[model samples]
Target: MGDVGSVGLGSLGHPLLGAVVSLASGGGVLLSGRLSLATHEWLADHAVHGVMLLPGTAFVELVVRAGDQVGCGRVEELVIEAPLIVPEKGGVHLQVEVGEADASGFREVSVYSREEADGDGAAWVRHAHGVLGSAVPSSETQYDFGVWPPVGAELVDVSGEYVRAAENGLEYGPVFQGLRRAWRRDGEVFAEVGLPEGERERAGQFGLHPALFDAALHALGVSGALAGGSGSLLPFSWRGFALEAVGATSLRVRLASVGAGSDAVSVLVGDESGRGVASVESLVLRPVDADQLNAVGGAARDGLFRVEWVDAPGAVAAGGEVASRTEVVRVVSEGPDVVGEVYGRVLEVLERVRAWVADEDLAGERLVVVTRGAVDAGDGVEDMAGAAVWGLVRSAQSENPGRLVLVDTDDVEGVGGVLPGVLALGEEQVVVRSGVVRVPRLGRVRVSGEVSGGFGSGAVLVTGGTGVLGGVVSRHLVVRHGVSRLVLLSRRGAEAEGAAELRAELEGAGAEVVIAACDAADGEALAGVLSGLPEGFALSGVVHAAGVLDDGLLTSLTRERVEPVLRAKVDAAWNLHELTAGMDLSAFVLFSSATGVLGGAGQSNYAAANVFLDGLASWRRAQGCRVCRWRGVCGPRPVA
Candidate 1:
């Protein structure tokens, strides 16, 4: 063998090096010889962290060559008789039996630098592998490759690129290993990174870890040019769609940008092949410099918040998409008692106005009551005789004519004390504390509002009646809870299949299944659908499950994944809420997931998208809307 580190013939080097060299695995014989020397020296220096040597001809040669230098009689015995030997002084080392080595070829190898020897580092590596393995296509074949550094080696330098290069080439580099590799793709991005096959099998099932998802988002910032050269950070929203469960071996991701201007959206799709998968969409805000972030106390201000338009017009007639601005305001509550008192006053006014409208409209000639403190004072009322109260009455005037009445009382004893006498003669009346009015009589009146704090029927209009999850939830509702009617809302251009499916599933369930396909996401379309509902219909529930899951990681995910999913989940939810905000409903079941709670490794981009669902749930609940955060888990069957 050549001198340790020097490639040549007839050169003497360390015995350990010679043994490493003698076996020609790849490259030139001389090159192999030199590498053997370098490997042995590297292992011996500072004691290797985790290195396992399998029993074979090469191993035997190494032992024979070590001879007297084997140190410790115990080491010699381990080399000679034991099926496996661990170098006690160095990192843990296991010498596998020759038979075992022969049965399975080397899979992949993970060489960790000395610095990554701690438990946290190990955990990170393991998590990364889970993300990578889960994304592999289901059709790939299995192979065994060597994993270097073994289990005890302290990783001095751990790189995703290095691992990929060792496995195959630069093209095969795993994206999740580090930030560098993840930022390469354009329009969309994806990566497959993880522990070798054997290692993955050893680790068991892994959930999507938040670190990995965050890293993917970081990579997206770099790839999409969202991150400025000065390293400023931007705020964004993410919506994720869960497709399947992910497990060990490989991971895949796709990414892309959707929308534009100050509020841009990025989308990411991730998969674990035949296992669990998901799609995520992130709404990114304008970049903020470090100084600005610091001034805000490391927290983003509310004004910069973007309110995703719910059922807002998509792509205005001018060709640009419509966006909504969101502002966060902080209100200091004096106390619960004060709050209650304020609300009570407001309700009392509203009730009085309603009563007045009902009493005036009894003759039923489209009576409009404009009120100013329980007296009609506004000129907006066309018919003064038909109006119950008159004279520019700002306080008693209804906000909407023929539909509302307002009665304001300065003191508790001013207008019938706490119970003001407001009458409605004909039209439906809504009363307000400051003012009230009779609302216009539309052909159909749809009641959509939110309900909280109880187990009751919640109404949700499903536009795509035939969709999978939509059908599932609807069936469950009617069969499990005896729901009276399931108004299956769809677009005017919806396919006939949807109506057929709804009829087939709900025919005899006593639930009136109305199939109307108008873009549920469109405010006008939704309004029309609501107007068409039968009289006396009261919605008790709403389930927004209409969505799609596109597969791809951060780099490879595209607008195809980002926009539709966002429109379906975030935007759709908002629109549905707007259409039903005034109606009575008990629960709003938002299908969220553990992916949002825990981010996926290679699926960093996708996981970020799903997190927005959690934010939505919190926001709705704060508004007194009963929101359910559904976290889906997987596995074998077990008795409930």
Candidate 2:
């Protein structure tokens, strides 16, 4: 061994790794590279909840490549510790450390990275740790994808796999969409995965491109194995993995369950001509929820979004009023600042929508619901009660599509100049500020670092505190956010399934847990529970997580079916807001849903209920009240 700097670095022919060097120390090696969304654009395609991540397969590729550099062609074992997050800007400096080989010819290997902007002195976070073994034995099972699609295998539909993946927040862009075709045969699945011509041309730079390898796993989904119909699954651990060849542009894969009733699968990989490329004896995949990914992403998770008012040019009508087909219904605040009046006002707007849509004479006309300062509009809200109407109507707009529009104004007199023009433009939502017509658009919140939590040292109230979602939120608040006291409110309360266990768990974590039988939707019941807070514990926060689901298409839905869902959310939220309005609370959190933000086909009622929470949050924030709303994570639907 000579001076470390005197050792020349060598290439592993891997696109992700810059160079590999034989350490001056006995049998050691170091692999270095840099990763960024700009350079590795394909990484951006594999985003979970808007946070781009280096696919697990890429780590496998890096491990295999580093192993090959040291005459160790097999990845004996590998475990992913944390996600390798690629931020929106800047790159991460990566290092693959392969330790000195042992007497049995096995070596320790690990992958670590740090933000390039953090400079060299910054702490390096290890993403993966594994072991490398001697060269793969040549006598291993060989596969030549000779017959193509395999004889007697039934073709599996892969067209909608990516679509379904997107619905679960596993958004795969074109580069990562490599599942070309798949087949099933006698409890085993086979697939042919290939990269696009552009990506294929770059395949020579790596052992096997991650996109191609990941697509091979998509075949399991077609056969109801592993991550079938539950949630997105990511590779957690690998055992006895071996790679014989490099630069595979396309892969022919065979996946079989490790044993009966087992979620682990054994994978065999080969080239199109049937030459062995890689093999995994047992690969265990674990379910990954958005929260886990969001924690890794930190503030990078779906960056904050605000309603931006972009100028809606050409939205002025000729002489202020010209469209005869457009009808405007102005909704004024029901009364002077009342806590529960917003729910009644929203109900009135809902009925008006029902009547307008049901009327044959008005079938061709677009009903625009206008309000004064109902939306923040880059300013504060003046009409809090009228704000709930926006949420109700957005659902109506979703269910009725093209039949309704929403408009909010700061000044009634100023709106007259742009109202007709804005209506003529047929935008779904519009805001008129000082007579300047503008439409709302969503822009990503530029995040710099971690956003601090506002949890205080007082009892936090969770309305639906015993449901599946409520339980998850309660535990999360205690474990992650450090809320020391909680008042769990539900109709069944302690009688609710797992309520006792959940209370015990929270209490064990040093939290004061109060489980009370109270219907959050019932104002008197909620009031009783809130007023009965334990001695020495004052209210510090409110989390309205209570809701019931009565999912049905718009045609099959009725006001009766919708009201229960609304009572649990809309009514409960109103009760909580009113009861806690004067209290100096630190956090007023609302559990909403993506369906509310973006309507679901069979969840109009649920969507309406959750959207009301969204509107309520905005309204509360406008009133100098501390409020935070999560539109998807803690809703009726499983957090994506």
Candidate 3:
């Protein structure tokens, strides 16, 4: 050890010092000869355990004179500079040698008692021995995480990479055990989980479960060390693009962080290829934290603010006092005076503007519309300004009363320079277009559309209708497709409180809705529901949206875990095809996931399930059924 080490151990008891000194000042004659009463008592108190005395012939000559006192020269040298000693022929020698007479009588020895014999006692001997003998447990066990299957088992080939990554070893048993089954290729990691093809009749194509998507995100974070970076949900917005509708047996994700600023963005891409399948760009507004990453919409939860400018020249109107008191004479020269016709035109324009205002649904919000013009008295400037102001007020009030602030251009000129035909509103917030915001709460979708001429009244059977996505699809079918009635089916009947609320929401949206609580996964239940529809009513279409996620490694996953998800999605799709056989239908839309194309880590089960749906959709399409499969890795984004 150097300076730092010496300082660190200065107060620590060193065993070597005691052993060395004990060999030197041990005998009664030597102790009496070398030490004074006070020094002897000090030596007893310090308890010197061992020491060494060297003879000149041996290795301790070459420096000291023959009569030089050992107490002063040798003893002091041994204590303060023993580390400088070096080994020599036949023995160890001090760097300096004493005279020949002194060296002959000198003896080298070591002394110890029972307590000091072992140097430091063996407190950790058992543990050290065990460590040497046994295999080391994995580092992953430091945390309370597990893998899907027990170690040393054959893995199953599910759908995509994500399911394999998550389920392969991380969730089934001990973490170390699970890691063994996973493999790393390039910069990405993959895992293989099992799928029981023997259960084919009951199973459907695998889809990417939300959990699998989330876990894949987690894996990306872990792989890139982005978990501790300055961006939260950094991968959500950027990487999703390339992964849009990919479904594969394995999912590969790549992450990159670039740019610098308060609003720096992190880009992540997921794909099975070395190139990305889906890319996400996330705008980080603040320093990343665990809470932000865990949040559904990343940092956008604060709400998105926007600025919109509307130019209105003839939309505002003057107050009643101006309109009532002001009167002007019009020169007339023909059957219809030009002044009268102009006044009529002005009135018609004002009415149209007012109607447009009244029809807007601002939800009590107000907006500001500014007009600019140089008015001449003969040009009806006062009336024109009044009409414009009135239009602005009416439009704002109708949209969302008080939400839009109406400002006159005349007022803005004093505070800032204004350009012709230019109006600026401070900031406005708009609704999220699609994804999670549009869906609202979990398991529901907010759907709005206009009803137009279409097929006559009939019930729409929406598989997974009780679920969030299904419910929204059902609402859209009823309101937009002109379906007079709806029959919603879920794995469980719609008797729960959530089902009731869904019913109310649909009813409020102007839909004649009926709830059917049946296991969409159960073909028999779905068939029975189809049979029980009101007699003579035609079927409009079916939307299959219900699905599940079973994430884990192929080696750790069990049959029970992976089968239900596939069965629910794929089986329900096929069952619906059978039940609606030969019936008049409009469109059959199947929901698939991007994971089926882009394998996801730790989501082999889910990817397998979604892949099943993709194949089933193609099969249905070939069978001459009007089927379209909407495949994508859907997350917090709104649906457009």
TM-score of each: 0.28, 0.55, 0.29
Q: What is the C-alpha lDDT profile of model 1 across 271-317, one tens digit per residue? A: 33323333443333333333442333212111222212121122112
After superposition, candidate 2 runs with Cα above 4 Å error: 1-82, 85-306, 314-320, 337-340, 413-416, 552-559, 600-608, 631-640
Expressed as tens digits, the lDDT of each residue in 1-640 for candidate 3 is 1121122122111111111111122311111011222322211111101111121111111111111222222211111111111111122111121212223344221111111121333111100000000112212111111332223433433324333433322121111111112333333333322212332221122122222233334333233323312123222111111123323323343333332211222333232333332333331112223332233121222222222222233322222221221111111112233223223432333343334335445333333333221111112122222222322233223333333332323233231222111222222211111100010111222111111123334566777777778766765454334356777777565765477777765664345666777877677877777777776545766677888877654334455764575567655766787778777666666787655443444554565455445545544554565665662111111111
Tens-digit per-residue lDDT, 302-328, candidate 2: 345766789886646534673676767
Local distance difference test, each candidate? 0.34, 0.75, 0.35
| Candidate 1 wrong stretches, greater than 4 Å | 1-460, 490-498, 601-609, 631-640
Ranking, TM-score, top scorer first: 2, 3, 1
Better candidate number, 2 or 3, judged by lDDT: 2
Q: Considering every candidate listed, which one attains the maximal TM-score?
A: 2
lDDT of model number 3: 0.35
In model 1, the number of clashes is: 141
lDDT of 1: 0.34
- TM-score of model 2 (CA atoms): 0.55
